[model samples]
Every structure is written in structure tokens, then in C-alpha cells.
Target: MVRYYGIFFQEDGQWSVRFPDAPSVNTCGETVDEAIEMAIDALSAMMVLGRKGREYGDPRGYEEIQAEAKDGELVFPVMPAEKAMEAYRPKKRINVMIPVDLLDRVGEFLKNRKGLDRSKFICNAVESHLQQNVEAH
Candidate 1:
């Protein structure tokens, strides 16, 4: 339900969008409509990534953003879909106890798998086990 303020500018027939609140977030498209769509995507992605670094800026009021708009710039308010936000929900950390031998086996298995880590391996294993159990039932 959070809202962000953005400015859209058209140049040479292409449209570009930028968030005043978040200087690091911006996108462009062939048309104004397309630019708005891309802006939503970029905003949603930044929202997810920002949670990790905790550095995303806060949105300004409508009047404030509109007043700052320059010539040929259109001020727009964007609200990211709740579903999109939930889809990129942050991971939760939890502690687990495992036997020493199994821990060693996990480490050895990960050593052979490039770009795979203990967290991903464990998550996949647990999901697979749950799927099998559900299917059996």
C-alpha cells in the first residue's frame, strides 16, 4: 500500500521515469504507458533490494513533487502491487541443529556444486521432502 512519487519525461519520442525519493531507481520505455509499467517494475525491485541494504529514500508529498517538476516533466504517483511485493518477500533466518557427520556431508556436496550454498541446498531438500510427503498423502 506504499506510494512513491516519480517524474516522467519524454525525449525524442521515448519516455523515461525517475523516482525523486529514490535517486538510484529509474527506467525508460518506448511510450509513456510503457514507461509507467517499467517504473512499477523498477520500484518493486528496488523495494525488495532496499530491504536488504535499508537505504531506500522516503516518498515526498504530491504537491512537493509536482512543484519540483521541470518543463516537459510529468509528475506521477506509483503504488507497487501488494502481490508483487509479497512475491519478493525477504528470507527469514533460523537456527537448526544437525549431526556432525551430516554437516560434513553437506559441506562436501556443496564443494562440488558451483554457485550453490548451504541455505539453498537445505531449502531445496526440505521442499522436495515436503512435496513427496504431500504426494503420498
Candidate 2:
């Protein structure tokens, strides 16, 4: 998952924040604090909308649920593009067992048409699952 922020300054001396991947949101403040308050309100409203509309292709719109906020800003889960790339370098080895049904389902994933080792497939799956629930502050 990628999280990006955009700040827009209004003519009325207010500032607005936005999530590029999520256009439904725009937070604004009168002063920086007030605008931050308003932006939080906007972020909340946008989440409600995303949930209702099933944004991000998740019926629960769980991605819209942010982590506990910090400094009045709503944050979503993500890896910086460069850091994410680094994750693939010098990976370690581990093993675990899943239920037969679960393993079968993972095996059925289309992206692994040719083949997908459990580790790589699980990594991708975990990332996708995290996008649905994990978030930052």
C-alpha cells in the first residue's frame, strides 16, 4: 500500500490536506489548528463515504478506517516506495503451516498462475490484508 499526502492552500488563508489515492478527502483549517480540525472532520466524512461506497474495492471499506490519529491528522498504512523496495532485498527464511483449505485457496490465486512459493505469495497476501486494516498515525 502507498500513502501519499497533498496540501492545498486556499485564498482565505486556510490550508487543506488531501490523500492523492483517496480523492474523497480534503481537510481544511482556518488557522493551522482550526483547519486541521476541519480537515479531520473532512477525513471522517470521507471514510464514512468510502465505507458506504466500498472504495478501494473492499466491501467493508476497511481501508478507510485509519490508525489512532496523532496530531489531529488521519493516517493510512503504507510503505515509502523506497523502503518497500528495500523489503525485497536480503529477505530471511521462515516457515509456518496453514489449514489445508487456506493453503488451497492461496494456491488458487490468479497472480500465481505459473507458481508461487508460499513465502512470496504470503508476503503479497499479507501486504494486501494489511492494506485493509493496518494504518498509521
Candidate 3:
């Protein structure tokens, strides 16, 4: 196992830092990096706090944090906007070819003839055919 430090940032931009297995945690930094730096700076304060009959709680014991950090991955368990955007990106287009007789039949069904293009008509026919046949099975 790798032994180093743990770090986290608060909503108000304060940093909390601690060793992997230490009771005395430190609160440091203004920005995240600064806060993390401060967190280590405040490590001495953690030891002082312990001397004054206080304790820093183990944060990972909380079920929510443990669940989120499962499998070495951060699972936020919340469907926020960033996650949704990553999930909904567009798919690549694909091309397909079919028989001449089927393509000709789609062409024959047009009313205002010139504006009705071959590809659009064939796509509609293929979609209809797939829907009907797929549901039958």
C-alpha cells in the first residue's frame, strides 16, 4: 500500500489535509493548492489540538464518501449537469446500401416529385421496415 497524505476542499475554499492514518488533521490553503499546502502547515496544529483534548474525526467512515470513492473511482451518485453532458454526446453517422428495386419503390411514392430525394425516402422506408419486422419477433 502507498503511504502518503489525504486531501479535500470545502465549499468555502478551505483545504483539509491529513496523513493516510493520522488523527491530527490540518486545515490549510486559500485556493485548492494553497488550501492543501495550508492543510499540511496546520498539521502541527492537529497535534496541538490533540494535546488540548480534541480529536479530528475520520471522514471516510461516512457511508456517502466511501460509496462515492468505491473501486478507486469517484462515483458522485448525483446526476449533476457535467455528468449528463458526458452521457449525452452525439453518435457517429453510418452509411448502408440496399437493392435497386426497393430504392425505386420508395422513389415512386412522391407527390411533389422533384423535391423528394432518394436518400430521405429510402431512410424512411428502411426505418418503417425495421420497426414492423423487429416488433414481430
lDDT of each: 0.84, 0.52, 0.46
lDDT of 3 by residue, 22-129 (tens): 444435456666654454444434433342555535334335454433343221111113323333334356776768887667657675687557655665677899
Candidate 2 wrongly placed segments (more than 4 Å):
1-10, 51-54, 57-137
- Local lDDT at 70 for model 2: 36
For all candidates, the clash counts are 0, 4, 5
- Cα lDDT of model 1 by residue, 1-137, tens digit: 68998899987789998887888888999988988888888888777767455566568799988988899899888888665665566799998999999999999999989867998789889999999999999
| Residue 12 shift from truth in candidate 3, angstroms | 2.5
Q: What would the per-residue lDDT of candidate 2 be over residues 1-137, giving only the tens digit for each residue?
A: 43344344453666555554555655666666665555545544444334345455322222444332235444433223443344434566777778999888776774547645767778888898888776641
* Candidate order (lDDT): 1, 2, 3
Q: Which residue window of length 10 is worst by lDDT in model 2?
A: 59-68
lDDT of 2 at 3: 37
Number of the top-ranking candidate, with TM-score as the measure: 1
For all predicted structures, in order, the TM-scores are: 0.59, 0.31, 0.27
Candidate 2: which pairs clash? 27-39, 28-35, 29-35, 30-35
Which residue pairs show collisions in model 3? Answer: 28-35, 28-38, 28-39, 29-34, 29-35
Scored by Cα lDDT, where does model 1 land? 0.84
In model 1, pairs of residues that clash are none
Output the TM-score of candidate 2: 0.31
